[model samples]
Target: MYYQVVKRLFCIAALTCSGMYAQAQHTAVKEPKDVPAEWSKAYAPFRMAGDLYYVGTADLAVYLITTKAGNILINTGLAGSLPMIKRNIEALGFKFKDTKILLTMQAHYDHMGAMAAIQKMTGAKFMVDEKEEDVVKSGGATDYAIGGGVSTYQPVKIDRLLHNGDTIHLGDMNLVMLHHPGHTQGSCSFLFDTRDSSRSYRVLLANMPTIVTEKHFHEVHEYPGIAKDYAYTLQSLSGLQFDVWAAAHASQFDLAEKHHPGDAYNPAVFKDRAGFDKELAELKAKYEQKMAEEE
Candidate 1:
């Protein structure tokens, strides 16, 4: 009888210890509060291909996918960028009021700062991955990337919650969502088909698999499995097939080199298989190096 009582006590003690460890692992990490100035600069909107348009800023990326039914707007840039995005969309001969849906690659302040404002202005339904819904609803306050830092923006409502492999259809266009977490819990990549004058091209709206935290793996309380998630995201990104790819940031796609000042619309420049491969390799290398360092 005494042996059984002692065993029960041990089991309860072990369970209590496990619960304490989990609570500790979920403690928020600190984050920087400054918003980069360059992320707000507006750029001219241009047609990427077919009905797809680049309506984002010089550094931040926003894409407008237009169709007869309505339009889909992706990435809203910083809070100060709403007017620029509205103007850019108008410049492309698209009406902001016609936007039916709003989406984002991640819920970072830089990427989603103007989302709430845009949604309010256009009355568009905001869609996001289930994991990111809380982050979006709280602006940047609840984000794992934000930790307990002072990063935040206007809170936006999530109208639709998405999952991996789910399809978002607007008019004749269909965008396949690829859940590539780690950058943010709900960082997503999109794949779809678009056409230019004579040919159809598979386009990938890539969500980069870059690590943002300076915290070591074990030290990341807000996002405990961030390193593992990044590994999975990198692997998922490498296997994706697309004729042309653009990322969350314009710099990731060599936007300046491909579409310079007064340069004619040439989608061919974005079809660099070698560049994509190099980027993937470099990202993977960085992830590995970070992991080693943390170890």
Candidate 2:
């Protein structure tokens, strides 16, 4: 299962660059139509564990962490995905207007495109890693991944800036932020505890460390330490412990395989230590191979 998941995720990552480039090049106009059908398809939202719900699309991932005070929304997908995301949240018996905070794993266009609109509609305070604040505010214009070129999406104001080891508290929930760079200078992973009936689970929202650009690591002038950052991120992630883990991209966590439609909610499928270890190893191997090729 682990090997199969790794093969599937690696293939998805490998195709991302070509898919993105093709969309950028072949689109007649830069509109929502440019988004691939796979990414834009809507998926029914469902609860994953205590207070945590999957409110994202079939491809892009967005999560809603509920609390007595309000709710925290993570990763808004593309700018055109706002409606579908809202419907998903509402479908799950969640009030979209009650969302109090907005967070993201990274500041990429695809992940944070609808952030500004969501923040405006919910009047939520947008929070992000300090390292990602600039990129988020500029809507990927200041991203090291894009060579500092202006990218798509509307820019947003970051209401709060966070650092590594910082904890975000709301009601009875607490989430510790972990800085995992390389994918983006301010890429972050989050750790929190969620309960399922009698069992307590440590859940980690993993920020992927995949290299998305075609440029060689050393040649990335906008982010000179890309290679070093990835090395540090890989080391940092290995030390953390979690019972159940999920990633910013749904495919990374094998969402479809773990949770089928109308199936009884079982968090056990998410508890795969072997799968996690294998995934990290594969990602590290890919990074090393890229470095070797550049050398």
Candidate 2 per-residue C-alpha lDDT over 1-295 given as tens digits, one digit per residue, 9 for 90 to 100: 9999999999998799879755643323122346666577788888887778888888789999999899999999988899999999999888999999899998887788788889879999988999987676556767776624555667677788999999998888899999999999999999999786778889999986987557898778888888999999999998889888889988888888888767777777888787778888989999989989998
What is the per-residue lDDT of model 1 for residues 115-190, given as tens digits with 9 covering 90 to 100? 8778878899999988898777656777765535444676787789999999999989999999999888899999
lDDT computed for candidate 1: 0.83
Model 2: residue 144 alpha-carbon error in angstroms: 2.2
Per-structure clash totals for the candidates: 0, 0
Off by over 4 Å in 2: 1-36
Instruction: Kindly report which residue pairs in candidate 2 clash with one another.
Output: none
